[model samples]
Target: WDLVCDSQSLTSVAKFVFMAGMMVGGILGGHLSDRFGRRFMLRWCYLQVAIVGTCAALAPTFLVYCSLRFLSGIAAMNLITNTIMLIAEWATHRFQAMGITLGMCTSGIAFMTLAGLAFAIRDWHILQLVVSVPHFVIFLTSSWLLESARWLIINNKPEEGLKELRKAAHRSGMKNARDTLTLEILQSTMKKELEAAQKKKPPCELLHMPNICKRISLLSFTRFANFMAYFGLNLNVQHLGNNVFLLQTLFGAVILLANCVVPWALKYMKHRASQMLLMFLLAICLLAIVLVLQEVQMLREVLATLGLGASSLANTLAFAHGNEVIPTIIRARAMRINATFANTAGALAPLMIILSVYSPPLPWIIYGVFPFISGFAFLLLPETRNKPLLDTIQDEKNERKDSREPKQEGPSMKVTQF
Candidate 1:
């Protein structure tokens, strides 16, 4: 479109503006979700994206198309951020990461399959329209959805939250809803809240605390690294073979299969161990890809594609884990922070591809470094296995310090019981 309108020079700016919109959207959506409710904001997110994306499909000029794309990015982030929040709320403690990751992977699977369909139809705009249609359906679901239980409980709405939980239990046919709900603890918490009413401060006033700020800042950077590495690998996967598109398609298929299996593994395996182990495996596969890329021209592409799937596992985990760490008020912000970094990495990936013309697999070398660094980051994070997500920075800070130590079962760690 830029070329068609003889304004191709604006493409770079347009592209960044499109991404910048998401950055702004991430921050704003986070704030909005905190101020409003997750369900309400999620509906707005879908409405914004569906309407904007449709306009983008019918845009008459390059500038107009770029504007619509920018709008779509903002709206799209809202939808994804809400979805992350929803999946986290909906999942059992044991399978939180797996549930969220598998669900996010479903997005990748959907987009790839859409591309496959677009290949057959051969109309880019129509394919886009097809993709945006799902958002409208999601908007309907959002209408029927409940707000996050944690958020509801913290805000003094346990009765409302419990009602929602019973609805979910009935829908899922769980016989004992209240017995299993985190809301039971929250109900206990109300008495504590009354006792501590004068002593406790609000989030806005308390956010200025140095310890609180420092921990959240550290969390945000870690999230940034995870997203950067995740998207870096995804964007670089397109560079693996002589037929980049085919390689992407193949990995897309593997991603779908992996998504189907990953949830069950996460339920049993837990997040930290699965993430660390998978990153280690991804690093090994990448080293193999680098070695094979030097000599095996005929099959290196297929081998490299396999290695690409290894990195995707970490990407899936990060999306889920981001939601776990932050409280409901800041959940969207935290998720968006990760997404913002992914977008940055995605934007930089094209430049890496351009540089790779001078040197093939230079991008792969850089891409491979991501999972390795992520593996190291895994060492610092505590295991959230079977633990409910902390709803405040204070809760996280005291979680390990105050809790009783787990009983030793054997010489081996329990994290990899799966």
Candidate 2:
């Protein structure tokens, strides 16, 4: 209970344990969601978080607190993974970026809310309970949420898929849905996808295919670097300002603004380009923090805030791009693989902060370099802007082939050339 001067390291240990739990959750949740349905997993995770997170608040001892937190971490990761999948599945390509961005913006809102709550409530247990209780509402309402039609069809439940589609169409005021939307039409529409889904692929299939393996490997590394830099800077924020609450609010505000701008920015730039640009910007900011004289407190704080915002934007891009590029059949598994890398870096970020005691610039230097490397690595992956989501490995192959084929000259162009 006494996490004071002698036991301060226990705080870091608790964080590390929580990240470890998330890492495990990413793996377990991904497999389960892919095996079950996104709606079911989402509801279960909400309930788990509600119960486990509330218990964490009332823990009797530090050990009990950490254990509950670990369980809560698992639910939290599952919540994130499934929520993103659900959002991607529901939103059309035209609105997918905006949908995911809006979902992610809630984190920024939560951060600001936490800053306010932590300021208003001095008791840590009360703050924890306050946040945990809301999930109960979410879990109760989750029953009304529709299961993903894509998941239904791909999993060989065409009738259920058709029923869900009709419900959606009816909700959208499409009167013809009852007469027009039939099981045969649904099967014909997704015939290629349904056929491809028949062969169940393991997670290892990601590594076995050269193109997918390369993309996954690079994506995993990018996630690792982004999270390490992001969390390292976050953990080091205490040194940047005297008012933790004020600093936290500013951080959240900047992230919210950055996410709000992303949907607009994606309109002009490809996801790969935006990610590279942000990663480079993040690297420059981290490096600048080391170069800036410690006497100039204002400049350092500005750089740190900008760096955090850049990292947040880059993270959003990575998530959106991954979902877009990865085939639906193995998308959850690929996300799990990347999240494992991210949570691993997240676990070590606290340890990197510890290095600041021995050498001030050492942590920032390491953080600065990883993003710089990953920025270029992003160039290796294909651009997914304006592309339809691929449902199977064969779909990905066909897309790649289409992309590679040279465009034939139009009649107008031929006449002009003649």
Candidate 3:
């Protein structure tokens, strides 16, 4: 990268250009995904990522590299969010949360693999080529990707929706049921879906409800804290000690380990509670680093690793929780809104590290405060464990009402495993 730009300041800002693009992509790509189809948008996004990311590796000028990087960032963010949404829409309600959690875990593993590859290759251009290669894999596999049936049904393409549903039924080995399923039944279902969509207000109107307003504000803040802490700690790998590659490898390992444990935590706790716990733990780890004496450098390294683990866990929880809380109709848009804020904070994290030059503990203290205060934000969120995905504002209202209502005890009680 220095080959392209000799100015330290230009090079420094170049690091954030990708995230700035993500911020723009989250809004623009998100709206486009909602307006277009998920599979359609995903295919194009992956194609963009493959072409633009590869081109970025070969750019002659720093300006050209940054430009391609920005376009790649937009494609990357859209691919991630849309794919998650696509899977969530495809899976049954019983498995939706778990599917999202597993998807997040896979993402962590991919990052760790990338880090290991970078460590081995050591050439920036070669490493860039290696990383960009996976986008082509996504493009190849996208042919088998199904258009979201819910989106199809809601958008007045009931025949296409029913076809997808039938394919799903066949894959699930419900051949007998598939034979019995008729267009009339699907048409009736579509009618109800259309009526519900009509009854619901625009997604933007969700902010009007005081409870929802507060919840969005808090959740968005948590996302901000999640990214700030995540990128901040990752950026500080060199400051931890010598052997930058070793430190990064260890950081990736910590993240992979944390992702593995997140599913168990989600199983035992509400998503809201899990997020708060992870954030609080992250805060403790960061504060430990700040309070430790410089002479005890070893202890600070351990604290940093733990902090990275906590941040990774918090990120996974945030993604799963976000999918559950948002309605299907505008989920892509809502996720983009969250991503815009999160990536903005991420873009600022490197600058926070630069602040450490003036004061040794300044960056740690600033980063620590974000997640520490963010835990309280979860208090405003409702638990979505074992609940159906809310498709409309009315569904959310009814879900709250249902939760508030008392349960009647019966002779034969059934327990659910989330």
Best by lDDT: 2
TM-scores for all candidates? 0.69, 0.87, 0.84
Model 1 TM-score, 2 decimals: 0.69
Candidate 3: segments with Cα more than 4 A from true spot = 1-6, 9-11, 170-178, 200-204, 270-274, 291-298, 319-336, 380-418
10 residues in a row with least lDDT, candidate 2: 409-418
CA lDDT, every model vs. true structure: 0.65, 0.86, 0.80
State in Å the error of residue 122, model 1.
1.7
Q: For model 3, how does the per-residue alpha-carbon lDDT over 1-418 read when each residue is reduced to its tens digit?
A: 5534335446546667877777778778766886899999999998898999889889999899989988987888888878888988898889876787777767657756766887799888988988887889979987977899889988878888888888878877886756667778877856866786666557667667665566667778999998888888876676775566666766877877887887787678788888888899999998788888877767878888888888898887787788788777656556666877898997888777656557978988889999999999888788888778788767877877988899987856866573
lDDT agreement of model 3 with the native = 0.80
- Count: clashes, candidate 1: 0
Residue-level lDDT of model 1, residues 1-418, one tens digit each, is: 5353444335445555666677667767776876687888888888888888878888888778878888887877777777787787778877776677666677657647755775676786887788777778877876777777656655667788777878887788998776776665657856664344325455575366554444355455544544444454455553455655566677777677666666666568777778777777776666567677444654766665565565566566655565565554445444555566666655554444444556766766666676677677666666676778777667766775665666557756556646
Model 3: weakest 10-residue lDDT segment is 3-12
Better of 2 and 3 by TM-score: 2
